[model samples]
Target: MSSADSTDAPIYAGLVEEQGDVLAEVRRVAEEVLRDADRAIDFGGVRSSAAYR
Candidate 1:
């Protein structure tokens, strides 16, 4: 195989190994956003009142 083809496997393997970290970071950010949204709803009282309209 050529050098380019040989390097492909290791590159792909490294990406697979790093997938968990990537997913964890994504989940962490998503949870933080959701938590902030919940806090906004609670403190702003937008759910009980239609003040947005």
Candidate 2:
């Protein structure tokens, strides 16, 4: 959904490129995959999900 801004850049210049890719992937998963599941867990409880078994 939302893209990272320049201010979101990592502190270590050497790791900037690598960390940026990693951060993007992590954010993508959070917004796409985990978003709904996170809400479900908060409302229904983690044990209610069959995947948690």
Best by TM-score: 1
Residues 1-53 of candidate 1 have per-residue lDDT tens digits of: 99998989787779869775676788999999999998776755656577766
* lDDT by residue for model 2 (1-53), tens: 24465545444454765455676778898898777886666755555786677
TM-scores, one per candidate: 0.44, 0.30
Report backbone clashes per prediction.
Answer: 0, 0
* TM-score of candidate 2 on Cα atoms, chains taken together: 0.30
